[model samples]
Target: MSRRQRAASLAQGLLVGMTLGYTAYRAVTLAVNARRFPRLDRPHAPLRQRPRVSLLTPARDEAHNVPKLLQGLLSQGADEVILLDDNSSDGTGDLARDLCRGVPGARVISGAPLPDGWSGKNWACQQLSQAASGEVLIFVDADVEWHAGALDAVLAELERSGADLLSCWPRQDVGSAGERLITPYIDLYLLTLLPYPAMRLPLVATATAVGQVMVFRRSSYDAVGGHQLVQGDVLEDVLFAKRLKARGYRVLGALGGERIGVRMYQDYASSVNGYAKSWLPVHGNSRLLLSVALAGQFCVYTLPWMLDFPGARLLRVTGLLERSAVAWTAGRRRPADLAEGLLGPIGPLLQLPVYHKAIRRKVKWKGRVYEQ
Candidate 1:
């Protein structure tokens, strides 16, 4: 090789070395702290009486998922359920009304029109809160199917922790490689950056949410001005969690593990489209920052595998050590290994196009299409 080529190779080797070292450090840190991740503590047999709990669901053209949700909430040990049908063209409104008709303390209301400066889900949630009378409000998405004791367990946690807000990151089910590669990235990002223990620290303010389920104290909800305070946010749940911390509230997040799980999208197209719908608004309209974020995700996730390729044999030695470290940090050997060594390379490739489309596409969200 020429002198310049030798120098370039050395530089690449050094880059790989630093990257692997950082990966190992993060992995070990994560594994050591893994025990701190939240778990659902089973309610004591003589269960502490929970406050009056309200199941607040915001639905829009969720007819397919609504039935399952209705069934799940009805079976939970809660005081009442309020389903806010957010102007569905499908039979969602009718289905909601019909399901609540004979069920005790169950009621459904058609949400008001979407006003200016308000994101759809937050607006719908505002309406749901207005109609709710329970002392504790549980925000559940229409897509989520809850188990019989889920609410009871969540309520128990809220009471025991004395937290103003409680949420859980449900286990995600992935059928296809697309789902596996893209879906878990969200979880990895969360666990890597917002480890449960760090979230309690005041300097920790990177907003994160398991929007599938969030339970809030009625007074705490009102104290932070509720959904109305966050109406303009596209990522309302994330914003709400941050706002709660900013306002001196104890915000607790649990690792759903297998307790709560949701199938977020049906297929690859749906998954891509779904993310595109909110990508730009969530990034504050800075495409440059968005590009940088995407690039960072790619490098961090894909670096290990690239090192293992035949042309990059030098990287395999470095990559394997780093992979071992990430595995340690995440608490599960297989997930961290696969995520860093295998999926890491492939995962970010899928995201680049999604970012491009998010910049160009006029997309539909919750039945309403918005032009970018």
Candidate 2:
């Protein structure tokens, strides 16, 4: 065989071998590191002393979804449910107050004007935190819905783990074909790459938090400067987790599939824009890192399917299976999304333009322009 043919054969072998090795590693890590919330139906002895729990939500132009979240929080028996309408042109503040009228311990606070150095959500959450009168603070997004006993389950997990902060991954409620093609990757990356158990280890910087639903002990929140430390950060959840980890606090992340759900975006356009706002900051606002990361994602997820060299089919099948397995482990149950995981690279590929926009400080979210 010619030198070129021999080189091609070696590369094919390497691809197949690497795929198999990585798949096995993911499977093992998932089994050991992935933590799932207890089912609501499962019986557990109630805590003798229920701590005061506050439910905090920040909203901007989320008038349509805030009512649902309010209803869910009201049902959860929180001591206080505080909503911040973040300087929305839409009547979000009025709608929130109307929804909570006559509901004991529920209040809506109009967010102060955006301060010079703070992101909108961060400012909103800081206001909520200050107004909170509970020992345990739970932050839920307006788009998220909680099942019966969700709060109890989260508190139970937090107590059991002895974590200073606990974050839960909600089940993705996909609406559009675009959502199916894109959203599953969030879980796939976490399952495959993040060392979930190491989040609690001292001196280890590995940390991740889902902002959709996070429960924090008031003490821990205060210790980390609450959201104040990450005031300007677009990805506040991640930075908060890192801050907690850096302070030698225990941070635990669990699957909330049985307890909480979120419809992250309505359609293709929203998904592109919504993800870009958070994704850009997660890469440290570095265009070079974003490019390298996207290229790596394509190689690991898309190249196998696109290539026709010997053993390519084996590598492709392995890639698809690996993604599907990780997605399932992360609480994605939709058959369509599982199938779409085969085309996982599409999500990252579509975000290339968004990354460029983000680097240029041109990304708009909730009608607010954020400068990088």
Runs off by more than 4 Å, candidate 1: 1-14, 41-47, 175-178, 204-207, 281-285, 303-342, 361-363, 369-372
RMSD of 2: 2.8
Q: How many collisions per candidate?
A: 5, 0
Write candidate 1's Cα lDDT for 1-372 as tens digits. Answer: 999999998987776666556555566545644667665543324347758889999998999888888888888857889888888889998988888788898888888989998889989898888888899999998877777567666766677677788887665555565555455445555665555667667743644576778888999998777898788776677778887888788887775543465667777777887777767766776778788778755555566455452324544444344434434433334553355545444556877767978887466666676665
| Candidate 2: tens digits of C-alpha lDDT, residues 1-372 | 999999988987886677557656766776654543233334556776789999999999998888778888899988999998888777989999998999999999888888988988889899999999999999999999888998888887778778888888787778788766666567766666666656656754577788988889999899777899889888888888888787788877877766788888887677767778877677877878888777766666677667776555765666667666666665666787577656654545765665655566566788888876
Residue 238: error of model 2 in Å? 0.6
Q: Which ten residues in a row have the lowest lDDT in candidate 2?
A: 33-42
Question: Which residue pairs clash within candidate 2?
Answer: none
**TM-score for each model:** 0.84, 0.90
Q: Highest lDDT among the candidates is held by which one?
A: 2
